[model samples]
Target: MQSTQLSPRYRGLRLTALAAVASMLAACGSGGDDNGNGGKPNTKPAYIGAVTISSYDGATDDLLTAGLGKDGLASSTAPLPLNPAAPTAAELRRYAIYTNYRAIVDTSAGGGYGSLYGPNVDAQGNITASEGKVAGVEYVAYSDDGSGQQNVTMLVQIPTTFNTTQPCLITATSSGSRGVYGAIGTGEWGLKRGCAVAYTDKGTGAAPHDLDTDTVALIDGTRTTRAAAGKNAHFAAPAGATSLAEFTAANPHRLAFKHAHSQRNPEKDWGKFTLQAVEFALWAINDRFGAVSANGTRQRTLDQDKVLVIASSVSNGGGAAVAAAEQDAGGLIDGVAVAEPNLNMPPNTGIVVRRGAAQVAASGLTLYDYTTTANLLQHCAGRATALTQAPFYTNPTMAPFFAARCQTLAEKGLVTGANTDQQSASALQALRAAGWEAESDDLHPSLAAFDVAAAISVTYANAYARASVTDRLCGYSFAATLTDLKPAAIAPAPLASMYATGNGIPPQAPVQLINDRDPQHGPYLNLPSVSASTQRADINYDGASCLRNLLTGSDAAALALQAGQGLTLRNGNLRGKPALIVHGRSDALLPVNHTSRPYLGLNRQQEGVTSKLSYVEVENAQHFDAFIGVVPGYSNRYVPLHVYLNRALDAVYDNLTAGRALPPSQVVRTTPRGGTFNTPAPALLPSNVPPFAATPAPGNAITVTANTVQVPD
Candidate 1:
């Protein structure tokens, strides 16, 4: 690890900048004459709305841990708000930090929380007993147009230890559809290195508009009526051709998530939002540290030339970082480091991905294409004998549903089989043919049990189609469900704390995916609802198939969705910025074949010899680090991908700051901390998760030639 200390020259420059800022403030306070030009103060960016600034002392309240510190973060339970009915903005902020932090990171001691990576672990990888509490000032605002319809939240955290002379910035675009704090775990890497971390929700957040209650969330996670919030609302259901009152009356208890119903096709602007976040961070930093000019306007003390900026995050946020790098026409981004990015490859790229001598069956498919397919087949696939050892596979209660799904698939000719057993095998094979690797076999059962595929498919399909909440695209509606699995009004407490707890996508706690087309049982939860076509509890097969058909269907709605998917596709040109991408080979949700592998080929095709992208595929590591500690058998079979993500960040930072050679593209074979199933695995050690090598062994090297990416088998 590189030293965090500033050199003598940098220290002197920091002192000079501080002195200049002090002199300028004193002059302004004394109403002194302008040094040169007319007296004018620095102006905030036009896109930025009312800024909210708060300071933390690193004791009672702090940025990284939200006053909980390292120990508090390691606890199994999060601190709750004093008033469940209504949480204060401060309480919501703290809860957001805590929830988002644990969402990405494995907090269990056996999962390497304190040892490999955590608040207590320094950038230098040293284990410290001290609670890692960073004293910093937080600046938050909405990066919006005049309409406020696209009020993408942007936040900047500048730790007191930030080096003024050798300035650095890191972008942490929110992963998945989470709120601004979604990538807080990734931001910790930059914070520990004394770099300013810029975060954006990328136009998708956890602020669900309760259509029934006429309420919406604000930028600060506080709730208010849509009429009261006015242009300040984070998200408000557009009236469209019908009024809100009419829509609510017709679709009572239905909720509208910004990602699914904003009708903005927000994914298309993820990169723009991420770049805007960097701009916001730069402006905030300049506002604080820049020296006043002759006209009393704060001069640009830090910029692209003076500051080193790295685009980084994970999952959807990671994808946003890559997108930002591709769209960085202004040269704002210096490098990129991310893990398991949700990349959507352009059509007809002619980029082939191969493992050893065999070409991948399917590659470069969009998120909706693969996710909807998974939603259709994963339940049936979970019953395959190959996945018998998978977690959640042996539950007797779910077995009938899995069997029913296989029967339905077979009857529909989606799979050819004589019995449920054979149908399951066919379904599992279908998933592999669709791009999933054998390593992903064990993950399907648990992922299916959690409705991961259904939630993603429904959300993405609605988003791509730009459908309204009232449309309930594919007959799927998000709402609270009663004991009988029927739609019900959401409780006030959950609605109030949703901004801090909801993971944007529905089927989250307190919000269930309701099957509106279930004729046998009106508007019931998807899992227990009987499919209208099959008349069986096949996990809402009708809805899943409908979502899948959007890719190939030629209807107007399908055409619109296809158009929106096109707008989100990446050109893969990084403009020559050095970048590092690490993805788990066992990532079932966003398979490596469809994402990073093909993305590497696409980048090479676009940039050719000038491309500085390196891909690291880690074996035995999957998406969702939180699962490693909580899900049975996950800890014994899979290592935390978060460790490798940090390593990649470190490597990228070293390459930028010290001109160190970035690690070569390779397959990092990691060993899982194996133990008895359902029992906690042994404490993680360095050997369990090895670092990517600068010069990987011959068998592990990943090679790209003529826009063809080949990974070692």
Candidate 2:
């Protein structure tokens, strides 16, 4: 899931097909919008607002982008300490940032943001339109940086009939990457189960552009501090590719790592934007639509006080949801739900540390430095001799290239000697230089495999640079190979954009801080440090200068804040709310260890909160197959967990309103459907792995005492 696969731009065909099916099923289920409420409904009044809502699109003119801040100026407070080991509840409150919010949509006008629901369907696929209706509305949140407001679209679905006559439960959902659109893509079966479900496109939906990259620019800002970095300085375009994702994949520049940490603090943080969207939706349901009832009197659409929010995302979205809800010290949301969340920005640091690759690069340390070793070693061994070996050396197109590099290594005694990290770096430098300069724009799909070679080679080179120079001079080398280190084969952009997100708080565990030098990266530093490696590298730079600049500023105080914030919630600061954490046991992208343990511990340790948290694991699942469309036969043929998730939502609602204990967690077992061209042959998992079991973590669960929680040292 971490590796590049297909871009979202390529999902058009699949999305269209799925949409058609969903539409037909919805139409068949809904009883033609006629027999819904107490009587035949009439057209609603026009929305009285400063901006007019339009159909959702990527461009500004095609979307709604008007709204005034109800609370005036945004918060300008300094942020919490970068990575507090344990933050008090008061500290969290002090640093809790918010955007001036209000319901920008005039729901009383017309059809209320338009309906996206098809006729609702029963288990028998029977039409039941009168059961529920899904409506989408657009609103704007004032930017904290005083930038023009950001437009957010929300989808609200209310069951036509509820078990209780008072009103349906108000439940809002947030996803990590796809935005409001993705929240609905998972099927509305849960929305049909007697609740008003609301979701939003994190501010990125304001204009027509890729939500992920546009967001990167929004946070990083367009003004380039270094003119020498060039036109695409902040985010260099890949060779000739205009698309952002393509540029990132084709040229994995060092600056790309900075994208995750580039998100602005205070208002423009995407997480705050997402949470505000949910908050605004809840407000609209209560203050806007609920203000003018069906008969015109003030009657609510759903029980305003009984709001429960849930989140499930491929990466950071899940964590953002929890952070938002936690920061909502107003107690707006009653509960929380999370899927495999990206709790850490430069993820997999522990593994990198354990593997002796968390080296402090002269250019500044980075998780990518670790990945450069981990991924490459996973594919090719650490032998300089491997260069002359069969797989790569024998390929007709690659043989000549390998033969030349092997010769260079032989001349330097790098291949036949101990193959030290320095030697590995030098040998790789020779090979990569020849390959990148081949003058072939025609990239092969196998480039990803080649990328492994490049990454591994750089790991050694980075290690050498770290050791040979002082901490300030650490960075990318001047060699052309180190400068232009992309693979010859092209790859699609990574499935999800990495983000720096968290529920504002300290980490529950001791993370590998910027100064924490692992065995592989060399001696640790006792004080705050800066890297001057970028300055030296740029002087002799032959590669992408944009990426090169990130090396020097890699450990900047702001960068540390961005990376640290992404993992804040992983330390078990749940704010004493009932919660559920679900993860796929086989999720290659976000390991379960990263999401489940600390969260479960925090809740379980809290006396009254223990029963409020539940953790579930799905067996034989990958990250994507569980959410969006299936990947055919490579893993699960289909993800059948919506019913289970709905069940979790029900448990959450019960715990919130009725004071009932949450259901025990369990392993949701799955069977592999391996056959067609789309499907790979299914293999059984190892016995050591648990098969979707949620029996709480062993040992005493982590407990938060007086709002200050402890983490693993």
Task: Estimate, for each residue in 1-713, the C-alpha lDDT of model 1 and write its tens digit.
Answer: 21233322334445456534433453211111123334334456789988888889999999899999999988878778999779999999999999999999999999999999999999999999979999988998998889989899999998988776678899999999999999999999999999999999998988799988899999998899998999999999776556778878987998899998899999999999999999888777766766667656665556555667899999999999999999999989988999999999988999999998999999999999999899989999999987777888887878898899999999999998998889999999999999999999999999988899999999988889898887778899899987888888999998999999989998889999999999898889998778989899988899999998999999978998999898999999999888999999999999999999999999889888778899999999899999888889999999999998899998888877666778889999998888887678898999998888878999999989997899999
Model 1 — which ten-residue stretch has the worst lDDT?
Answer: 26-35
- Per-candidate Cα lDDT values, in order, are 0.88, 0.32
TM-scores, all models, native as reference: 0.95, 0.46
On residues 1-713, what C-alpha lDDT tens digit does candidate 2 reach at each position?
01112222222323334323322223111111122244322222121112222222212111111111111112123333343423332232122111101010111101111121112334233445332232333332222322222323344443333222222333333343223334442224333454445554443221111212332222222122222333222222121113445533433321221112112222124455555555544444343333232443333332234344454333345666655655666555556665655443223222210001221112112333323322222121222343332122224543333333333344434343333334434534432322211111111112222432232222222222222111212223111111123212111121111111121111100111121121223222111111232212111111112223333345553244334334342334556566766665554334443345334544444433434566675654444432222222333232333334444555555555455566455455555433443433333222222233224343212223332222221
Q: Residue 144: error of model 2 in Å?
A: 6.3
List, in order, the clash count of every candidate structure: 0, 31
Off by over 4 Å in 1: 1-42
Q: How does residue 656 of candidate 1 score in lDDT?
A: 73
Q: What is candidate 2's CA lDDT for residue 645?
A: 46
Worst 10 residues of 2 by lDDT: 503-512
Name the best candidate (by TM-score).
Answer: 1
